[model samples]
Target: MKFYSPLKNTICGVLTAGLLAVPLSFSAVPSPAAEADASSLIGAAIGGIAAHAQLNAVLRKYNDTDEGRQEYFQEMKKQLGVNEDYALNHQLDRIMTNLTAGIGAVDPSIYKKPYHYFINNDKSFNAFCTLGHNLSVNTGLYQTLTNEDEIAVVLAHELGHGQKDHPAKGARRSLNMQILGAATGTQAGAVMAAVINNRNITKPMEREADALAFDYITHTDYNPGATAAVWQRVLDLSKSQPSSFQQFLSDHPADSDRRDTYVRRLTQYSGGHVTNSDGIVKVNTKVFTTPAAVGGMSSKERSYFVMGNLAAAYHNGQNKQEVTVDGNTVRMGNQPIMTCVSGDEPADTLAQRLRQIK
Candidate 1:
């Protein structure tokens, strides 16, 4: 019943080190060949079928029973710790909902599954989603984000993963890579890296998620400028460090290209670089796991090894809990915790203010 949240894996790995240290900027510079296609993905050995099958299995199992569904939510609630501030949680929920209202209206069936949120107190920027529309946002993510538009970009990107089944899709992609490597003589350690290092399937997934995020936020009051601006901030903030090193696949995109994509998406939306955001947004969270249930190594274990090697390579360092919600209260075990709305501010108003730079 457990499922892995690769985006969280992606999120958690926000502060990574790179060997080549090819610094990038979030500006618009295009490339014809960098986009993803399943056929040309890695050598000619792999296809998308195996990956799809892997995902199908997870989807099927999660839907098989009420117990499975309950367990899925329970594990997530227990594992990803959250000290929820009701005022914040309620505000986030309302804003996230209102922002994505168009999507819900267009196809409510797509959202038949329940969605929840978790807020972690991490200072660094990271947000990720699980298989069943569960998402986690760092509390400080709001602090770093300059406006609602940027938050929309982050949340929408994570939503895109759930909508597109990117985590399972990525897992399937890794499974394909694993099979292809075994058939074609890839080295053991190298194969490990390709399969679960977050390297093989991440870049394409990132691009796809970015595209989906843009799609969701379009026509909403959210400004497209903020979309590109936040990523640019990422480039600006991380400039001193080495380029980020994800385990398996990476966009390795120059910041310029990444920013450019968002800009282009915005241009398409408002026919210009700047637009007034009249859109609303709201929230919730969870972490997911699919532990390989094997005789030997788990996917997480594989990453830990690769991450260790990666750290040893850089001689540097790196680094969830659980909670429950009942009606308007957030809790830990039997203890009921009280949360206040901080002057009774509406979610929409607070959300709007939170998005702005201090």
Candidate 2:
């Protein structure tokens, strides 16, 4: 029930031992090494029993019933202070509403246990859906991502986790593993160690959530390209400010992989005009742009950004606008697609090329 502050920090704490603590008791002194080993084993057995019991009680109290779930939510709010700013709350509400409807469209069973969510005061780029469909979004996520579509991508991903009941299922798995480890005696605390290291959320679960997010976003009015854009932004930010995102990046899949996955998925919604392979942007089966390192992003990283812009333009009908050159910028209507640099073709030339190809 207890965890660290912020969301990711709290999850890391729980993953480590905040919630799954297996206290180890040791004798002051043992005359013989054999006796010492026996005493240690005994202590592990006792600790394992206590940890198992505690986890079971947690499941019953928090995941078993609606009343228990509501009680846990109150406790969570108290632990992580809620953000009461009217504007922020309203923004979160609007985003959540859209995401909820989108999720319901994909799987109406989501309505069975309607989500309860609030913005937490924590300034970390993270959000979580815990037991009982209770959700919390970090204020930092809002502060970092101003785009509503990008925000929907994140919330939708968390909703995916909730739809599959990952939190409760993960907890149950942890409990079973704890009991198994205790029974084995040789691998005491192995499961706890793994979870503490942030390995509890397996890669498969993350992939599934990501896939679900893609589906959810497509169903909503939000631009689906933002799914790839968000990860591309994260990858770019991680380069200059790695420490700022460690807490988030630690548990999720690699940012580049995520970007690429969503980038490839972009074709599904883009009508195949826009597609990316490894970060190379292709429009209408032709290389639209292969962006080089501009700003702090690598060539590949920058390409995803270009791909996102192209996907957005196509998604929102901006692609119908005339491709024009204004200074070094290429624009479709008022939307700035990308800037031409020294190594690249002239903006006017590129704009004309895009017009022909687009």
Candidate 3:
């Protein structure tokens, strides 16, 4: 008998190991345990084969174009990193189940497809909806929020994006390369993954989402003001950390104008409502503090301070008033200190205004 080579024997052993590791794939019909066991291994093998076959089909479609080939392969590599695809899918399914129930309470047709969530371990405060019914939220964001209202704001924002079909628009853009036959199998995978992984909230889109979120929460017990508060917190959070804003700013560029937009929308939705007596409003101005600074005073605090100063001015009834600061006397305006900080003015003039106020 001819002597067998060790390399060949090793190859055979490796192949056997792979065969054992294969998982079964099944159709609509359920399988018996014995059949299931065999099917699992065969299924895994078949799945891999099927994946490759699909990849090849995409590659062939894009083979004539270099750009297409590049895009295709990139998309392929992204989908292959499934450590626990099944578990993730199941968890996502459950989240959708709950979301569906929640949304159904408001509008049963709010979402056409079950919304999916992806927990990215990134420190950035970002969340986005993607093609094929996926929504990704950064772990950093989830940790930052104190209540369900904040979470609801973020989720509803993404849902708004989904409802508006932003993801589908992105998908169409990616497939534009396919028209040129420039995408490869690998590039296609990359494009798909990118299409999946990208969680950007554009400014207009962000505004739209904010509006939708306001609508979403107002119908429920959740405070609509939390929507504005979340953005305000994001703004303050960005100033000190800078990094936290990276993802948020990327998706939804935070212009002062955008902040104003949110404030305006919230105000309109609430019919210019100021008080949160219902306990539904969960405003955490502390959440808006910069990391370097101590927790900044809340909007409410600033408002109260102004109101108190005005009241004191009225009580004194002076045209110009002087109040004791750290040591020196600070001057108030003839009109209840029209501005917060006093500008240059003669001590006599300031005193004159204080006397007039009363």
Candidate 4:
């Protein structure tokens, strides 16, 4: 199967696994009963057969191009023990697929679409962007992720690589290394170090992906600052234990700029109007005179958001207590809040005025 399609997908590669491309098997097919409790809370695949075909075709196309045909592509998968079977938790697959669509909806169409995703059984926290657009995350990564938002951040980062064409570029470098190795009679490791294996390229590619991910999150419901936390978690998890894996951490240096980048990007988008450390604004309707007076004891704030109208009315109090939605009807608490009003303030204004009281 092949796709002459336009879509980008990326997964973080495990450098250690690149030494060999062995196949992986998590288990014989898990029984339906065993999966009952762990099933994807996000319903079944959205596009059904068509979606499955698109995803599978993209995966197959990874082998069609010159770079894809290179032995490194196959060896890399093998070294990582690529498994297209039940090696992953089915529930996780469903969750990622759902989130993929949600994030894609917000990203530039040039870099966003329903890309196929898979999970490797490896118990280490890593992901990979395959030769073309295939995305894979390790089981350890899925389990290690604290929440769905972090997972989205990771996926967005990988997609950022895809959007930037880093995978194919990395492959080209690897291929060049092999040719140079043949010509100069140098070791593969020595040849790789000159380019693809060089930290110079890898780190920048990662930082680029990080920036793209930051942009994506701000456009979506996920916290824009999620990039830092997730990247930090990946770093911490990489250095945690089983010291053998630590070598991979050293292979590609983490970006210190990301710490500041996260804060800077959110401020750029939200104009520093955002109030919460979580990167989301919470609106309180308990009718407190001032945020300081409440002393942060307000509950029932679950329904309020900085981008919602109630948030605007609660904060600005235009004597009208009104808000406007640009598209479609606005609903709150399952009740019709209001219609899109040209005269009312945009939701983002509230997002700007929104600040964390705590």
Compare the candidates by TM-score and give the number of the best one. Answer: 2
Which is the winner by TM-score between candidate 2 and candidate 3?
2
**Tens digit of lDDT per residue, candidate 3, span 1-358?**
0001212232234333433342232122233343336554554456445433443443344332445434433332243222234654454455455545656676666554445355554554655554334456555665466445556667777777766666445434343433232211123333334333333334666677666765665555444545655655566656778875664565565645554555555434433322221112211111111111113534532332222233333334432345322222333443333232333344444334434433
**Location of the lowest summed lDDT over 10 successive residues in candidate 3:** 285-294
Model 1 stretches with alpha carbons more than 4 Å out: 1-59, 63-70, 105-107, 181-201, 240-253, 272-358
* C-alpha lDDT score of every prediction, in listed order: 0.45, 0.72, 0.44, 0.44
Model 4 lDDT tens row, 72-174: 3444445555456563445556545554555566654644333455565577666656445556676667556745666777777777776666765665555
Ten-residue stretch with the least lDDT total in model 1 = 280-289
**C-alpha RMSD for every candidate:** 20.4, 6.6, 18.5, 17.8
Check candidate 2 and list the clashing pairs: 15-196, 16-196
Estimate TM-scores for all models: 0.52, 0.70, 0.46, 0.50
lDDT of 4 at 280: 33
CA RMSD (A), model 1 = 20.4
**lDDT of each residue in 1-358, candidate 2, tens digit only:** 1123333444344334533354452112223342346666676678667766665665566665788778768867988998899987898889888988999897999778788888888887888887778888988887567767788899898889889877766766765666554533434345544333324566778889999999998788776767887887777777777887997887778988887788778875666788887666788988777776765445765665567667767766888988888889998776677888866667887788789888
Q: How far is candidate 3 from the true structure (C-alpha RMSD, Å)?
A: 18.5
Supply candidate 2's per-residue lDDT for 351: 84
> Predictions ranked by TM-score, top down?
2, 1, 4, 3
TM-score of 2: 0.70
Q: Which residues of candidate 4, in runs, are more than 4 Å off? A: 1-91, 102-114, 175-201, 232-245, 252-256, 275-358
Q: Which of the two candidates, 2 or 4, achieves a greater TM-score against the reference?
A: 2
